[model samples]
Target: MPTLLTRQRWQLLTCLALLLALAAGIGLRAPTPPDEPRFVLAARAMVETGQWLLPHRGSELYAEKPPVFMWIQAATYQVIGNWNLAFLLPSLLAGLATLWLSWDLARRLWNRRIAWWAMLALASCLQFGLMAKRAQIDMVLVALTTLSLWALLRHLLERPNTRLLWVAGFAAGLGTVTKGVGFLPLLVLLPWALWRWKVQLRPGAALPRARSLLWLIPAFLLGTAVWLGPLGIALLNDPSPELQGYARELLFKQTGTRYANAWHHVQPAWYYLQVIATLWLPGSLLLPALLPGWWRRLRRGDSRYWLLLGWALLVLLFFTASPGKREVYIFPMLPALCVAAAPLLPGLLRRPGPRWLLLAYVLVLGAAALGIGAQLLGDGAWAHAQLARRGMPETLLPVLGAWLLGFGIVVLLLAAWLRQRRAGMLAVLTAVLLWNLHGWGLMPALGPYSSSSALMQQVGERIGPSAELGALAWREQNLLQADRPVTDFGFKRPWDEQWHDAGPWLAQAPHNRWLLVLEQAISPCVDRAQAVMIGSANRNRWWLVPGTAWNAACHAELSKDAAAGVDDGD
Candidate 1:
């Protein structure tokens, strides 16, 4: 047993533990709202329509993002033949790759011990764990960004290896194609130049020539060309205004305009400071101790810390400058921070202060979980109200409460057994346990309500097989989970326009045709007495409208709104 705990064995065990934690709840739930369903719907369309170059949502082209992530999903689905598993696999694989890259980079920069610490720190981060388990593009983008950073660091610090330089360029290019910010890793050049000017180089170490760096342009271009090249040709060859509009929107508006003046999710400059404190928690709790030490190193002109910390700061500043902000935008910088902090974690963990903090954090988390669980089980009014508001069945309250109680009890007991002496280990254990319970128990329980699967299922049952369904102001989840074919008025089109189109469709076959209309989207012309209320999902009430519910008088109103270009809602 002692022999089994060898260094190699421990590393393997760490990886296996990470995998198990990340893979816990996959396939148990369908894709939920905000972003998951949209991506999956696009991927499914790709597989079904054989239209790999462009992604379509219902009838409209989805130009908000590049097709690379969708392509990965489509490819994964083709091989596995399971949408649930396939949609999530890319993020999982990207997460594992990210962990491996962080481990390897730390080992190369410092040693095996530090590598272990880096991987563990990154894995234990709440944001990292959250992104890893979801089918999101940010995780994949993080993986690519980390890969570019890893290669760039090696090339700049270790040796002037051209191949590594090309690797860095290509990865960033791929990162750009994945999402526009892929070129962020190249920002390291500024710090690298500053370090060269400020610090003395070790014997036989020298910076690469200016000309050698030029290779990055082509490499990066090659990466973007993977998606852009095809898109450009398609746009040029086909004179269709829709494709041209998609190209223009994707190339310019989505990338630059959105960043410069974000129309949604706007936040103040200091918002990320709050995000870094909370979302990056447990790991972020160490910052108070780590920052001073890092500053000391920077003051002494330590090039390693300069490069890693400097690049991370630049990435933060870059995102902070943007009007549009999201926590995941800075996720790529996490690996670099973990690597820089890894060598110091072992020392920090030995100190009593960090240990007590970790212990306290664990206790608070466990207590919160326990308290929330007890509240639900005791028929707390707040708990029941929350459940009802989310469209979750009241029957699930006991089961959810039991699961939370079990998690809390186990976590609290483990913290007690480990005490402060092994609080660092306790922290990792707590994270694993929390994620496992979330994935295996909590997420699956929330699946029906969260994914709108229950709502769609109920819609199917009420309408019967013969009824044709059309949707007004429909979400991606509604279309994805529908039992049969669904006709959706354009997703981005105005609610009035959608109502204009849906009214006539419902009027076509009043007896057999039904319309699933959003409560807000249902115009005053529709008769509420005839429309049946469908349960809420995704925070919106839906109504099943028969042809009898449609007032033909409303058509004149809808036409006037459409002709006037009066956009009521998105």
Candidate 2:
């Protein structure tokens, strides 16, 4: 068995393991909020309307992000004809690509063993696995950035390969289109230039010429033009105020202004330090042993360390300087960090201290899962309250509890069987188990509530076939999950404006029209006596308001209330 598990077989096995872990729940759930539903909604709109250029959330344009990621989702849906799988396919593929890039880059730089370690270390990270499993654009961006960095490193450290440099530049551009941070990989040039200036090169090793580096300009522009060219043409031909505004918002406000003066998600400068320590776990666990080795290599003037570690530091500082901070903002650096740390892991894992720490970490995770499962099964107050707060059905509590308990027992048993010598294997296996449980078990269990599919279905059933449905202050999940066509007032428009418009629309066909309203956005004009209360989903209650529920007498009062509630901010 050991002989059969050669370097190639091990790499192939590792890739398969990652695929199972990441793709476990592809078709089991609908997109849930914070970001998922909005993107999926926009992609669905693109597919339905056949207007692929600009993304829309209900009737309004979604300019908060570029259209590249949504385009991928839309394209995938066109091919596969499955919304669930298509929505998440890009992230899965991107994740696999990212792992391959990390592995291959490490192998080229050092050896296959180091490459395997790099891939495993990265796949075992909490953040990496979390992002890979979601339909978010960050994983795609991470993949692109990793590709760019991998190519650039090869060109800079190994030989003056212009083709690799062009590949790096193009990938960085596509990444920027995915998320504004895509160009981050190009920051490697700064470190590379600094290294060349400061250190002496070997007899045959030489840096690429300045002229060859200039090829990046056209390659980057070509990539950027993939999205920008069409957008610019659309803006010019349409000349609509809305389209023009979208262009400005996406190009400037969402990128430069948001970064320079972030109005939301504002965190202190040291916020990323906390995120790295906690969210980047298991991989981060090796930091104490790896840091000194990294410093020693830096002192010895290793160009590989200079390119990877230096670019990582530049990325850290770039994000740190911004007022706004998110944990995922620094995710693009994880691959490079993993590759840099890979060569040291074998030696570190052989030591007793790191092995003991890995064992303890896994044991603690198993114990926590067991304890929480026990609490839930026992019908503890905290467990019940949590289920109630999330609007999860009480009946599923036992099922969820049993699943967690079983997972904990299996994890503990596996750890005991593997012991400390195979602590790395234990960590990888535990991660796989956790993700599988989350995807196959927990996600599907939570899908009905978390994605608002249950609530939307109820809304559809209550209204019947002949009734028209409209929404005020509706979330993306509400709109996306609706069984029939739903008329939304506007996603970003003020609730008062939506209410004012919705009232008249409901009045137009009094008996046939119904308005689904968010609990907080429901105006005083809505008579609760006539309105039906739909159950909560995504932590917000919903109301199915009939035309008869509208009290026109309260219009003047509602205007005053709306005026009072107005706040000027994004």
Candidate 3:
């Protein structure tokens, strides 16, 4: 077995390597997450109006979420002045920060071996890597949740310090601001309190002293009051009928009741299982083998391990119970699950005679890389030939080839390294992190959403500064801003308001030359001339130059599509 310093040295190296991998992923391309455009547009609206509390875009009420995400977006935009990178930078930082916290937590609980494995597992995972680079609230939630968990676990293991509890409270509060009230401080604290209560009942166990509970009151007040208070006062002072409908639909019904009612019933419980299988990929397979050992440790009175276990379960359950489910929901749970599974790697590689576990991982990942690489290569070659004919540099070919070859090389190296006991463990962790950073972190930002920047510039060239623009979907509103338009369509959660309401407002305004943005799926139904397809990230979005009587044309086209059985793949 590797000594503590030896393991620490390796872990430190792995951390640095993973950081580079993630950095490469971050730097190679600038792609904003899907929601980033919406948030950026809303932040711009804030900057324009000097109304921080009431987020808006033109006539639309843009308060689907609390302002924390928008605030981050606004800050990024304020500094970088580039919408895509600004929106992505915060989430990227959050992802990296979460990885660091996972290492710290792992060190506290088990040892350097487990910590390194856990961080590697997390950094390599498609789930975590992808979400961390996304322009969503999930990364922030993951970081804050991990910080809260680390603080709570630290308090539980050694002493019940009030300062740690306060920090935990602050983290929980911030986590609540990031996502909602479900996962962070609430589900997290409840389990710890109950477990601690049980410990107090034990004969010789020292109950958590009275001082430990003291932080809860201030944390509760400070966390809840800061955001909710201002929102309430703003609503009370100048209550718009628009905000009323929005508040009911977004803050309350959509997030709360819609789940039980099957509103956005995305998938069954098995949906997440499938997502976990693919998203977690090779390392995900090891979880079943690793859980037993960690479970036994927790059961045997290791409170730190217990806390981590509880953290993973609570995050998993939070998403599972939510009515709307998606693959990204499992992202925050990755760090904890990875750490818990880390300890088993050393034994699994050596004891299994090295043929089964490692070979299986390499073979599976290798096949997957080959399949994906083949498609990318064909596309790149065709693109390169076309670019050469057009007398361009055709630079993208080498970059594409390098990525594909790098992925293959990492897979091969990990397989060979795993054959030796010492090298096997190190290679697995290191390779997983590098591959994940490349595959998820680098690819999505570079490939899918990166095209948005070009689209923004192209649209900016065509549109005049005075033209009023509206987005059919709230998401592409940032694209309009990126195009340097003075006024934009509103940000609404359901996004139905723009196609339904904002279209008419822009047409009626003095600004007649209007650019309306719509997703490609919605384009055929938008009966507007001068519509151009921008780019395909997760989905395709478009900007439309609406004619006079735009709303009527839009509705007529939509009705025609409805009759023709054309849906937005709804």
Best by lDDT: 1
Q: What's the CA error at residue 52 for candidate 1, in Å?
A: 1.5
The runs of at least 3 residues in candidate 3 whose Cα sits more than 4 Å from the true structure, single-residue gaps closed, are: 1-12, 25-30, 57-59, 79-85, 182-185, 188-205, 209-211, 298-302, 353-355, 379-402, 417-451, 460-482, 486-570
Q: How accurate is candidate 1 locally (lDDT)?
A: 0.89
Query: Comparing 1 and 3 by lDDT, which wins?
Result: 1
User: Which candidate model has the greater TM-score, 1 or 2?
Assistant: 2
- Candidate 3 lDDT tens digits, 1-570: 468789678667866766655555444454444565556666777766777776664455654577777877787778888764676788778888888888877877778657766776676666776676567777877887777777766776656677888777777776665566523544555566656655434466444665666676677556656576777786788678866776665567655664565455467776888887787865666667776788787677655555667867877777787767866667767777776776776676565544365466665665566555565556655656544443333355555555665676666666666544453454445455555646454365345334356555555556555565555453443453465543444433334433455556656763355554555325333444545544433344456554453544544334443223321211
Q: RMSD to native for every prediction?
A: 2.3, 1.8, 5.4
Candidates sorted on lDDT, descending: 1, 2, 3
Each prediction's TM-score against the native? Answer: 0.96, 0.97, 0.78
lDDT of each: 0.89, 0.88, 0.61
Q: In model 1, which regions exceed 4 Å deviation? A: 1-5, 556-570
Q: What lDDT is reached at residue 314 by model 2?
A: 97
Q: Candidate 1: worst 10 consecutive residues by lDDT?
A: 561-570
Model 3 scores worst on lDDT over the 10 consecutive residues at: 561-570
**Model 1: pairs clashing at backbone N, Cα or C within 3 Å:** none
Clash list (residue pairs), candidate 3? 418-424
Query: Ten residues in a row with the worst lDDT in model 2?
Result: 561-570
Q: What's the distance in Å from true for residue 416, model 3?
A: 3.4
